[model samples]
Target: MLLALYAALGVVALPRLLSQVAWFERAPRLAIAMWQAACASVVVSALLAALAVAVPASVLGHGLADFFEACATLLSHGVPFTSASARIALLLAGVLVVRITYCAACVLLSARRERRRHAEMLAIVGRHDSRLGAMVVDYDECMAYCLPGRHGLPVITTGALRTLTSAQTAAVLAHEHAHLRGRHHLVLAAVRTLVRAFSGAPLFARASSEIARLVELLADDVAARGHPRVHIAAALVGLATGRVPDFALGAGGETALVRVRRLLDPVEPLRQRERLVGILTIGVLLAGPAAVAAMPGVRAFLAHYCESFIF
Candidate 1:
């Protein structure tokens, strides 16, 4: 029951709390990890809460021998739940698992189909540029993005080519390359799955949108490592009006103005101690639920196995 309450509180509170923190803008990568961890924590706590009701604490205390015997009996005889609460708890856990799995499959399949269609379109209308290492489309809209996958590649429009100077173009391409190289699409896909699975859940919805924005900031940081920040900012400004397909990760989007400004006027990043604290927080968010769920089983195992041992 406590675990369920924790999950509920996290769903309602984490988004609001995390969003209010200013340090996230200075360290987008760390912020992304924190958001992901928070989501994972809620899911794990909810699942474990249901399982706790279905499985008796006494069975866990008896250690692995008894636990395995119970499992074997369950498998061999298909023993029915002894209580209505146990039956309902197991049903709840199973439904949550199946829903998430189904949603994940849907998100991945839809993204794959969209990418395939977009790839085919690109092959027809775009030509590869060896010097720039990107697919050049002859459209009159300043745009740049990457198609991420096995044959992932950066893409640019002729309009952007004419608009941006050589150095600025390099910066923009670098940003797209960072997205491809980092496999950031998979990260987006995972968050999208959560949002789809939970539909109107505020935590998943907010996390998905915020992570998408943070991803852009992260890519800009990567691009800045290889190119001048000013060049990247200038390229973003030039490509601000352009749009890319939903399947593609683009260099410019609604966040372009904010990203451009961030690039031009950099803020001080988290200090070493602050970063360490953030890392610890992420660890706790990820592991806290599992530790809570395992405490009874662990204590049981220790008692059964170490009863005869001397300290």
Candidate 2:
């Protein structure tokens, strides 16, 4: 029940709290990690909560021998739990796990299919440009994006080539390259799965949107490392009117205006102490639930294992 409460708070409270924090823009990578950890922590807590309900605390207190014996007996009997509540709790845990797995699989498979189709289309309409290190489509729309996968590559349109300067074009390509190299699609997929699995949940929905925004920021930051920030900002502004397919990671989209501004006037990265604090926060988010769930076992280890060793 305690673990369940924590999970509930994580789902309902964490997102709202994190959304209000301004540090995310300055430290997007850390922010992404924090969001992922929070989501993982909530799921784990829910699973642990159900397991806690299904297993009697007294069984743990007795010792490992008793714990194994009880589990074996249940397996042999083919009736997992004598108590209705325990059976229900176990079933709930199973449902949560299955739902999340199903959603994740669906999101990945769909993205893969889309990417393959888009790749086929690109092969038909686009030509490789050695100078640009990207496939250039003859389309008049100014755009740049990456098709992410094992064979992922950056893509650009001739319209954009005519519109951007050499430096701006390089910056845009760098941004797309960052997306492919970082496998930012996988991060987006994880959050998308959560949103699919729990559609109306504010945490999952907001995280999906926020993480989507953050990834572009992260890509821009990576691009800036190799190219001038002004070039990145100029590229973003030039590509602002263009759009990419839903499955592709683009350099510019609806968030382009904000991203351009951010690129032009960058904030300082998180300080050492602040970065350390963020890392610690992520650790707590990931470990706190497991620690709570293991309290009974920890107590049992001290009471039973320690006593036997001493004797």
User: Which residue ranges in model 2 land beyond 4 Å of their true spot?
Assistant: 58-73, 241-254, 309-311
**What tens-digit string does per-residue lDDT give for candidate 1 at 212-308?**
9999999999999999999999888777644343456554455877887799998788899989989999999989998888787788777766875
lDDT of each: 0.89, 0.89
Clash number for each model: 0, 0
What are the per-residue Cα lDDT tens digits for candidate 2 across 1-311?
Answer: 89999888889999998898788999999999989998999999999999989987768778668889988988898965869999999999999999999999999999999999999999999998988889999987787889999889999999899888999999999999999999999999999999999997888888988899999899999999999999999887776645344456655355877887788888888889889999999999999998998898778767776788999
Candidate 2 RMSD computed on C-alpha atoms after optimal superposition onto the true structure: 3.4
Candidate 1: regions farther than 4 A off: 62-69, 241-254, 302-311
* Overall local distance difference test of candidate 2: 0.89
How does residue 10 of candidate 2 score in lDDT? 80
Give lDDT: candidate 1, residue 61. 73
> Worst 10-residue stretch by lDDT in candidate 1?
243-252
